[model samples]
Target chain A: MTSSTSSSPPSSSSSHSPSPSFPPKSHTPATTAAGFIKAIESGSKHLLIKRFTLRYPEQKLKFVGDGYQFDPKRAVGIAGLRGRHILYHDKCTGCQLCAITCEGIAEAIGMVRVDEQWKHNKKAIMPQIDYGKCVFCGLCVDACPFYALFMTNDYELASFTKEHLIYTPAQLAIKPKYSGDVEIKIDDHGASHHG
Target chain B: MADLEDRISESQKMGMQIVKESDDDRLMTLSVGPQHPGSGHFRFIVKLDGDYIVHCDPDPGYVHRGEEKMTEYRNFIQNIPHLERPVIHDSTNITYSYSLAVEELTGIEVPRRGQFIRAIASELNRQVYTLYWLAIYGIFLGHSTMFMWPTGDRELFIDLLEALTGARVTHAFNIPGGVRNDVPDGFKDRCLRQITYYEKRLKEYEDIFYNNPLVRQRTEGVGILTKEDAIRLGVTGSVLRASGVPYDIRKAEPYDVYNEIDFKVQYMKTADSFARAYVPFLDMRESCHILRQLLDKMPEAGEVRAKLQANPRGPPGEAYRRVESGRGALGYYIISDGTPKPYRVKISVGSFRNMLALPHLLVGAKMGDMPVIYWALNYWPVEADR
Candidate 1:
């Protein structure tokens, strides 16, 4: 497919063809006028045509698939790939697997073992996730051997106040009620034990 | 003949005096630098004769972050994201090429779903990139509406992309084996809706800008680059097509889902600035067509990511891959020494290569035509200099 071919006319063809004497005269005035008219006609036709421009924002364009929604009870509640970080306070076991796996130098997560008073147990160590440094990389969730930590699809975590971003063990343990027949218990140990 | 001889004599006399002047006056050399708005990130020293640009020399090395050199240090897996930054707008294309290079080296096969997603992302990026070009071209042509319309419309596509991938601009969607993220729930429906909206809006784009008489007058026959000239200058993409050369990287070298897609390569024989502008408008329509086809034909269930579980760890090898970007054939040449980073990464950016044809295109053109010519070339300094 790759070849070098000489397209130089062999020099003989050049001699055979008659060379123009005056650099080939410019287009005639009649031909120029005709071209202009043709251009104008085509242009006029385009302008006269109907346009389909939607005035957005003022007229809110309804996106398709607003209806026929998936029920949260029937759908698997597993947070998909881009899910935000969540901490399982009870099952944490104080393992720093998530902290070790974070790629960036500026760690967004911190695993501080704070002593907690429980009715059944004398002392319990809980982990806290600092949202300030966390990129929601989901590394910590994967590293937790006890499966105490899991990510949630609820990503509306925006806050004007910086202090509100830092999630404590109590804030991280809040679980929503099941919309359907599925009954799930949110244990104080930060683990979801499904019966 | 007398008038021509008189003008020649005057030019010669002017040239002789300049040549005879002192070293400083011999050539009033001025630098149109590595940080100028009009010149991209490239520096240019132009020797001027009065107001006329006599001779111009381009100096390019400002945003050269030693990408090629950096590649030698990073592993194959890590280089994928690094390579994507050069032409960040065309994320899929860059990452896809890097993937191809890695595949070629390791002989790994990407699954069908992976191929489809790559194509989808690349085409979407192409559409948005074309809008960016159109907006810039609009401003260059003295039509403010064209500029504003495309920029505003671009946000819609960005929103759609954000819905699919977490990030909008730098998706980092494509990795070694396949895309990082699969099409999220309701993604296809959203994409179809956007496509529908784009189809309707394309007509408005034509009426407001392409069909406008002023735009046509300013562009038609302005920079006529013949097919022969295009080939000689090594032009690719829409620039080559504008000159009647039907050479598209997608068609010439069938990569990814491009071979499967039923789309025509847009072309025009005019080879002028108008033709350049026209090619992208036609391309947007083709992109819309391809998007529709992709949605209908995509597999219902399949593996999205590649099975290559291990991240690139060590050693370096060279990989050169090319893809049809919005501007033209974007080529990436990477040299890795089997390390964590690339030893040398050289990006043959589309805009930079296309810009090479500018000085030639702009020579006989008037000063008023500079902006039009600049926009028509569609040069991105960040992509070019990177």
Candidate 2:
């Protein structure tokens, strides 16, 4: 916020400044020859230049020492954050708080109800996330009334076709299959049934 | 002459009068943002006389998305990933802070494996952010080579991140108690290769950009912030470190696996833009050092998530948590009211706090020097706006 200025007295013309064009009266040939030799020895021209950069893809980098080390299974520390998607299908109580919080940027998630199957049974409605539109904002996960929907760190939703991106009930099941690998189940217990 | 007379007559008819004022008497009000490339998303108005800045006022809230108001409608577990977009470059740190707040409220102890992964992800993010800063700094100095090298080098790390998380920017990898997934097969080899590549490339960066005489000339003594001034303005992270404060959130408050790691918080005594730029360079080296240590110490195989006491209901209290972000300290304040959703969620972004000191640092500097100064600050617009 504060400004300070310093000014030095102006110098005379360049011609009046020390001119190297004139020979020094006390210059010695032997001293000049020694100075030239020193300059040549210290110059970068004689030093070996490095070509250390890699030609990537064709020539990949190799790390020294031990190989790849992955984290231990079920190893949580003082501060650990992971992805968890919960389905509170029964406690949902038909409130779309999640949709409201999604900010509507991607329209990636919604709630739907399936028709009743039996005589007296009520229709079943549940929240579904369309991975295609889900920016993974987690707002929809947070907006659930029953804590039924959550985000999982199982983010390998890539596919050859865009159609595969649309996640359904079976696709988003507690033990969903992702990228040909079995999804890591948090526990052996089945999905929680909340009423 | 006729056009000037007509303009004056039109102004008089429109009730706009010109008052003659002395140069020393009248204050020149200059507006410095909203749309200005130099200022991020916010604006500043400064009153000045000659080149000396007098009073400065910053105007914000333009990019505010009402996230706090919006959080009231979202559920507990769902909000974790929702909060990362504001500071996506430091995604792990942002999500980790929120997770810590929720864990504190719910009394959930995180697993060790998850802590290590969070540390690795955060350090990778730090490296990427520093690379981006270096690129921008190069652009500011009109050195295209410096700009291109780091960005190209950053792609190597990004590819490594993509391999680990399956996503680039919005990994949303951290949950309340642990990380979402464990590292995949071959991830260790990929990360190690990237580390080696970066180590070699860093020397080239030092030769081409860090030690470049032109860059040093432009940044060496520009926008100097003293230790007293930085502390008074509440500057944190590298900016504070540049002033010889030696206070880093990672050190002051060791969260995650930082306590277990062997790394040093880099500092410089200059406190100028050059020092600020230099700190990130050293930080990149520190990140590489930490990455090597992490690779060495990381467990072979284990579950990444912690076991929570069967799905518990939302807590009735609130908790606030802070962590070191790429820019500085990012904090998240969350309030739960016994419901599945949070009542209020507030995030204090590092870029916003860092950019607040811009007017103080920018004034009196020539207009041509603005871009270099802005680049050296390394403020992300989305984070600042959010």
Query: Model 1, stretches more than 4 Å misplaced?
Result: A1-195, B1-52, B313-317, B336-344
lDDT of 1: 0.62
Candidate 1 local lDDT, A149-170, one digit each (tens): 6655445577988898887777
Cα error, candidate 1, residue A137 (Å): 8.6
Could you give the DockQ of candidate 1?
0.05
Report the first chain's TM-score for all candidates: 0.44, 0.43
The TM-scores, one per candidate, come to: 0.70, 0.68
Candidate 1 chain B: worst 10 consecutive residues by lDDT?
B15-24
What's the TM-score of candidate 2 when only chain A is evaluated? 0.43
Choose the strongest candidate by DockQ. 1
lDDT of 2 by residue, B1-386 (tens): 99987987898687444334544566677777778655667676766766766655666766777666766765555565556777666677778888888888888777777678878887888887788778877876888877776786676565566545545677766878777666766666767766776776676676556555556567777888887777677766677667665555665567877777766667777788878888778778878988888877887866677665433345699898888777877888988887767778888877766676777787777655666666677677777766
True-vs-predicted CA distance for residue A74, candidate 1, Å: 19
Each candidate's lDDT (Cα)?
Answer: 0.62, 0.63
